[model samples]
Target: MTACIDTLDTPAAVVDVTRMQRNIQRMQAQADRLGVRLRPHVKTSKCAAVVEAQIAAGAQGITVSTLKEAQAFFQQGITDILYAVAMAPGKLTQALALRRAGCGLAIITDSVAGAKAITEFGRAQSESFEVFIEIDSDHHRSGVRSDDPVLVEIARILHTGGAVLKGVMTHAGESYSLNTLEALQAIAELERSECVKAAEAIRAAGLPCPEVSVGSTPTALSAVRLEGVTELRAGVYVFFDLVMHNVGVCRLDELALSVLTTVIGHQAEKGWIITDSGWMAMSRDRGTQSQASDYGYGLVCNSAGELIEGLQLRSANQEHGVASFEKGQNVDIEQRFPIGTRLRVLPNHACATGAQYSAYEALDERGEARQWPRHNGW
Candidate 1:
């Protein structure tokens, strides 16, 4: 008998268990081959069950974008954690609380002011916080430059103020814009060299620089080597999406995360199928628009997860999505996707789409489904 997953409520987030596990193992193997420990970013799933599977597959620790993730995962008994975002002074209390509760959380800083904040807070609390210097490898986002004179200055500030210098980290966030292996590999190499250079400079300044970390799903998979990096972090690879597919890292068959939406109605004249999933269900992130291939809201597929050629979520409302053929109108749209027909839409950004739902319906090889709870918000 076919699985009852199709009977679930419309607009639910679904995970193909086999594909999810395969994705996890593929990343673990790549990290092993590169000689760097895999510290997957939990912001992708924010579910303890998912992180547990990553750990079982040989992930050394988990990375987070917010303190809430650090706390939630810590409560589930995950001790090793790296808060990848640059630390904000106002949140030091929250970080301190997690640390005092024995979370083993490491924070990051990219400026002298940020370093001073950490030092002052640690001093007031009479504890030396473990911290990493954010290095900008591709000039993508927040981070001090690899060769900037301020790199050593920030390190000296953290060291002089009683914070343990944990080394450097850089993410080739710009790699997401590249589609060629050569471009991806070049950014990966730049990510490695820049971070290593920062760590070496800090160490040459008579400081303790033990870890050199860098990653992004594209770079992590594209890197031909990881000679000086000690650890790696990549999220979204756990649940490949349209954006990653367009970036040439994963294939359509590997997109494990999708929205299980039911065909509610159709506009026959316009050849559009109205689904219950809207921006509220799939998120408003159009990350694929700027990619090599724009998937509109998402790529539509049958209930069995097979792609439906030309089907695209062309438009959406708060609680509705208009799916239509990209190139031509379906003459019998209603008959093709009759009312209550089940379908799935591969999301543009797995992280954004996953946040729209509180729990995921995980479908296993037996065609059975179960719920996996996830934490959200700040």
Candidate 2:
């Protein structure tokens, strides 16, 4: 059954469940063809229901960004989790608890201090946590350089210090800044090369480097060969947003989640329409900063899900969004959408925007809505 449009609350995050499931299947299929494990990063969808859907689609393990997310998902019975962020001293207790609960907890760290703390915590607690040496592929974020001596040193500490040295992992965060496919492919190759190099380095040091994890939806989906990548850790593909589209990762039609909002006001002369959704409803994530065409927040769509030509969210306040169309633009947005009309707004960043909501209003192909709770904080 489809969700009755008249019954949904304004400024709610909705997921097209059918499309979401298909996205999961498509990603898994791609991973299968590449002969790698699909450890979908669950940070994009903190909703357990969404994770369950991913697990049903053959996700062997899940990736998360924070300890709170790890704890929340652990309580939901998800056993294998990779906290993709660097392991800090503060997160040791939580990671320990997750390990105690039968979770095969793995964390990424690049610094010696971080590694030592993690090793000490595991030892003191009598728990063995797995570790991934985070490799810096593009130098856009935290990670050890693939060729750095520190990579082998950290792996040695983890291997000898009661923690299992799982392997290496890296993210091509810089790929988001690429303006062309060639640039993205170049970044993808670097991602693969750096990760594989780190793995080979660890193995050369006589350490067991079993999993070479790599992520970034753009690189994961486009890279023709992930030669040494044992696992892929993409998160945003489940509910693609405008940023994914702008980055050449997915098309607008492939987006599976959007903000369901209601038109509340109109300024006929100015060609502006206001909706109940704003920065709070949609997030402040302007993932289009590198796009050729900067869509302020997202492309405004009509009730039937067609893009409203020339009408884009020009500005947003906490609870309101203003859409403006160029003067004399040949779009019939007003004729179909008046006050109280409901429509969906695709998000700029699925991870940030999706995190603002308490639950996902799952929708069917026919736009039927069902409720699914989500996790938040930390």
Candidate 3:
């Protein structure tokens, strides 16, 4: 086995490449069993190394949250990308450039105003584009009502304006509010029904509708059925976080990404151990608000990479983290974790935490280390 100290680094994100590949394979297998396309959301791991692995693992296409992400992946030769967010006017020129470079791009829109803006932009440009109508599954965020007349109206406009109407897309944001598997399943069913119904309405309006997209880590994993979903867009499954664990989607062992930190100080009287990792390293994502266990920031692991039993990172500031140990556990919060000691912290949200770093130190099954560069901003 490779020595653990050799892979140690302070304030860096570490990804177990072997475990990550396994997670990709497992998700692909599930998608194959369901006979649905797995278009993973690449926002979780902004590293091109991870994106290439997902593509190699049978991802039909990839989903990006921003046009900038699409541009980065496009430059890497990953065509056939879906910009899941609504296309804004400022991004029209960039989108057109991507299309000219031979990207099979599809963007989402929810209102006639947005559609008209795209139509006007397309008319001024030299290339035609594919568009998907965004449907509001639970009205928790941006999207047109699935059954709204505007759905049919927008499809007709896009088709008549020479924009290819691919289909409809919706996300069950409410699924995160679920307290049980049954509740998640119910939300998933609702998401599927809404997407399918929107597509049917567009078809009924004499438009060719070929795809129905549904996404969300919670609903995608727990949903017993994906009756009419043409593609699934999920990002968090690659690095199962504390939130996913609380929702019963994955176990802590399945998590592949974590922040590597070092103990910088300690207060023997107050019984607190301070680490160099803080909100800047772990992110401000408190996904455990609804869960019974609220790890203020994240779970702390010893230098050996094992969880410190009954210990939790109770609070974090800009650059310091305070860890609390269980009362009467007799653990040496300071003696055992002297200054310069290294530790690993599991974040509540992998995406937010991963974004804070410029690169990921990849580790193999034997703990060998390699660096993978990532992009940020915009």
Best by lDDT: 1
Please say which candidate is ahead in TM-score: 2 or 3.
3
Cα-based lDDT for every prediction: 0.92, 0.85, 0.85
Candidate 1 lDDT, 1-378, residue by residue in tens: 434576777888999989999999999999999989999998999998899999999999889998989999999999899999899999999999988999899999999999999999899999899999999988888999988999999999999999999989989899999999999999999999999999999999998999998999999999999998999999999999999999999999999998999998998877889999899999999998897788899999999899998898988899999999965544578878999999899999999999998998888988787888998988
Backbone clashes under 3 angstroms, per model: 0, 3, 0
- Residue-level lDDT of model 2, residues 124-206, one tens digit each, is 88877898989999999899998899989999999999998888999999887775678877888899999999899989989
TM-score, structure 3 vs. true = 0.96
Candidate 1's C-alpha runs over 4 A off are 1-3, 329-331
lDDT of 2 at 223: 79
Residues 190-246 of candidate 3 have per-residue lDDT tens digits of 999999999999999899889999988888887777888899888988887888888
lDDT of 1: 0.92
Clashing pairs in 3: none
Model 2 residue pairs with clashes: 2-368, 3-368, 3-369
Q: Considering only N, C-alpha and C atoms within 3 Å, which residue pairs clash in candidate 1?
A: none
* Ranking of all predicted structures according to TM-score, beginning with the best and ending with the worst: 1, 3, 2
Tell me the deviation in Å of residue 36 in model 1: 0.9
